[model samples]
Target: MPKMIFVNLPITDLDRSISFYEAVGGRREPKFSNDRAAMIVLSDTISVMLLTHDFYSTFTRKPIADAHRTSQVLLALSADSVADVDATIDKASSAGGKVDPGPKQEMGDLMYGRSFEDPDGHHWEIMWMDPQAAEQGASAFEQA
Candidate 1:
């Protein structure tokens, strides 16, 4: 069996988070979801468990850090192409997510990336990488 990953996050609104994830290629798994939590399946092996602050608190003794004020993690996902990275992030912004102000990164023809923040301010990065470009030592960076 293939290993699976569940990234658990504390969210203020379950429904809104689920909607946002759906816009970015996730499907809700009702079997593992409820009023307190929603399981958003991103891929066959990747899922995001959106839990209410109260529900998430039950699993940890530490106080939940406000994602709006401080970042604890940056959730990243790979895309098939640079266009996909832009499309996904654009969808996220249209769904009320905050697009990061940073400039997009383009590493020659090898890699491209962008970032966005969910309503709860959880950071997410969308990226694409090409092995052939890397193998040829192509670079977009200017040497000083």
Candidate 2:
């Protein structure tokens, strides 16, 4: 079997978080979900595990940091195009998330990325890379 990634998030509200993820294009997997936990499938190999604070504590003994005020990690998703990146940010905003919570990243003719904060304050970024340019690596573009 191929490798897969499950991003487990500590959330305050399970239902609301599920809705937010759905609005941002994730499909909920009922087989792995219950009242206290949910699995949101983002892609073929990527899924998000939304766990209530109580449930999440069982997995880690450390205190759960408030994502709103901390910056331990920044999650990013790939987009098919620059327009898709912008559309994702818009979807996040429509779902009550904070758009552009982090710095905007722009790479001339190479890449484009936008940021958003989920309702629980989890920072996320949607990015797109020029396929042709990416195939040649950033160094090749730098020399142009």
By lDDT, who's the top model here?
2
Instruction: Report the backbone clash tally of model 2.
Output: 0
- In order, candidate lDDTs are 0.88, 0.93
Candidate 1 regions with alpha-carbon error over 4 angstroms: 101-103, 133-144
lDDT string, candidate 2, 1-56, tens digits: 78999999999999999999999999999999999899999999999999999999
Clashes of each: 0, 0
**Per-residue lDDT of model 1, residues 1-144, tens digit only:** 999999999999999999999998899999999999999999999999999999999999999989888879888898999899999999999999999645677766668999999989899999887866645554533320
Instruction: Kindly give the stretch of ten consecutive residues in candidate 1 with the minimal lDDT sum.
Output: 135-144
The TM-score between candidate 2 and the true structure equals 0.95
The worst-scoring run of ten residues by lDDT in candidate 2 lies at 135-144
